[model samples]
Structure formats: structure tokens, C-alpha cells
Target: MTGSPAIPEASAASALVFVGPMAAGKTSIGRRVARELGWEFHDTDARIVAGHGPITEIFAEHGEAHFRALEEEAVRSALTGGAGRIVSLGGGAVLSSATRQLLRGFPVVLLTTTQEAVLSRTNLDKRPLLKDDPEAWGRIYAERLPLYREVADQTWASERRPKEHIAAEITAWFRANHAPAEPIHGEAKDEQHD
Candidate 1:
């Protein structure tokens, strides 16, 4: 029997990538989804921290540009890694055009939260950008919203919902839309025609 076209083995169809502003629960929710799906989970921010050091230290000592470069490297690594993964990107990871271009090959999900929700969930001490001015979160999110939209294949509003429920929704959507392709049964190479 004939079968539909096969997806590239290394394409984004093999992974679910989450992107959004700080406190949007990308890491937490992504972990849950990956666990439920029995897939690997990759958090680019965590990769940066493990490889370099704390992000705050990176910003304080090296500055945002340096941190962004490191972030892009981490993003590239996660996206290019073999599939069956849920990858969570830092809020600012989308700022790089190169990173955004890399994301175009994958299934990207945007997790969003209201200002009130984010303010309530945020630990300003850890966020270098919002440490001195928490209100800056609004302005920053506004500026980056377009970029987030540009890369996202699906937008999930994560405000005021239990992470389990949100993860379930994403999981269901992923399974439904990105189910593995069936093997082709037609045209066996070894068959001898009469």
C-alpha cells in the first residue's frame, strides 16, 4: 500500500519546543509533557547554567550579549540533537535571528501569561532584566511578543491553569498532530516482477 510522505528524521516534527516569557512555565510544563510522552526533555537555560554558570552571573560579569551568544549555542545544540524531545527555551532565546531560523524547522509552542499571573509567579531576584524594575517585564514581553508569535506553531495561554492540565492539552495536541508515520508497504525492492 502507498503511504504519505515521510517527515525528515531530524526535523522539528520529532520534537516539541516551548518558548515564552519568564514565568510562563515552559520548563515545568515541558518536563511534564516529556515525561508523559516518554521523551527526553531539554531546557536550554539549564544547559547554559550547567555549561557556563548561573545566568545572573553571566549577565553581571559578561553582559547580555555574551549571555545571548551562549544561549544561542545552547539552543542550536538542543534543536539539532536527535528527536523525541521536549525542549524549553529561555524567554530571550528568540531574540536571535539565527536561533529563530533554527526553530523554523521544529514544532514551536508559545506559552503565555498575563502580567498579573507572571508578576505573581516571578522571582525577580533571579531575573536580571526585572531585578531592578519588575514592571519592565511588561515592556519586555510586549517587545518580544511579536518574535514569539513569529516562531510559534501553536500558542498556549498558561495563566491560571494547573500545569498538569496545560501539559495534557499540549500532549494531546502533539500526539494528534504529529503522530509517527506508518511504514511503507508498497514496492518491495527484492520482489521479482513477471
Candidate 2:
């Protein structure tokens, strides 16, 4: 991590969008938050793998551009349809300007942590960007930091903590701001931030 100033938390959006580097706890946190809110949970990476095939194979056969195209479609579909759901995007999903634009009215949470924190969580063999290199991970994280910040309505550190606690914080925010009419939207009242 560079010595940049910490990003301030923003407010409000139609749905919750989680963005960050690989192994950043997006899927786990998103799932817990969605379950807490009784809404659906969608992970764009999972969708891509399900609909197309292995992402590595896609990159091998076609290219990164083609895989990103597929990602765009999956992200778009989830955004347009997810009114009360939590969405977890692939680490690089925000690289596209159009995707960033689409995220404007959505509650984006940038889940970030130091490389040391993610070392245990990371699956080196699977991520093309990291290529199992710690330095490569840092470089890519530095490159994507600005893009992640651009769309994030909130930012949270998931290092050495329970994902449920993080999910609870996000759930509190979503409930405070949106207050969805449905019974399953939770019963919290106060708005708190850390």
C-alpha cells in the first residue's frame, strides 16, 4: 500500500456493490450481508464461470479483453436486476469506465487490506493478475486502487477480523439509508460508522 490519504466514506445507492482486489472478502462479506438483509447474493466472477467456462481457459483461448467483455455483461445484468441484493464484483471489474458509470447510483463498498492480510486468503494459482507473486499483487493493487476508490460509497478494512462484523456494519448502513419496505430488510434503527 502507498502512503496515500485514506478515502472517506460516502452515502446512499440503490444496491450494494463490493469491489476490491482478489481475496478481499467481497464474496464472503457480501453473502453475509445479503443473508442478514434476506436478499439475494450475486458474485460476478461466479456468474462468469458458470455461464462461459473457466476464466483461465477464457484468457488462454481468447484474451483478457474478451473475458472483460463477459464480465461487463454479467455485472450489467446484476446491476440492472438487483434492487435489494448484494453484489460482489471481480477484482478488475471496475477497470471499465462504463462499469464505473453504471455503479454511480449503487452503494459501492471497497473492501481492502494489506498484502500480508490477504496472503492466507489468496489463491495464487487461480488469479491471473497476481501470477503467484507478492510484488505483482502489490503492483496490480496500486494500479486498481484509484478505480476502486472512484466508485466506492464506503470503504472497509477486512484484515484480521470477522467478516460477519464487517457485514454487520454494511448492513447497518444499508438499512439506515435505504430502509427497504420489505419485512426482510432488517429492523435496525441507528446509523453508525467506524
- Candidate 2: list runs displaced more than 4 Å: 1-14, 181-194
lDDT of 1 by residue, 3-36 (tens): 3133344575767899999999998899888877
Candidate 1 backbone clash number: 1
Clashing pairs in 1: 12-106
What's the TM-score of every candidate structure? 0.87, 0.84
Best by lDDT: 1
What is the lDDT for 159 in model 1?
94
- What is the lDDT, from 0 to 100, of the residue 96 in candidate 1? 89
- Give a tens-digit lDDT track for model 2, residues 121-178: 6777688766646567778899999999999878999887799999999899878876
lDDT of 1 at 175: 80
The TM-score leader among the candidates is 1
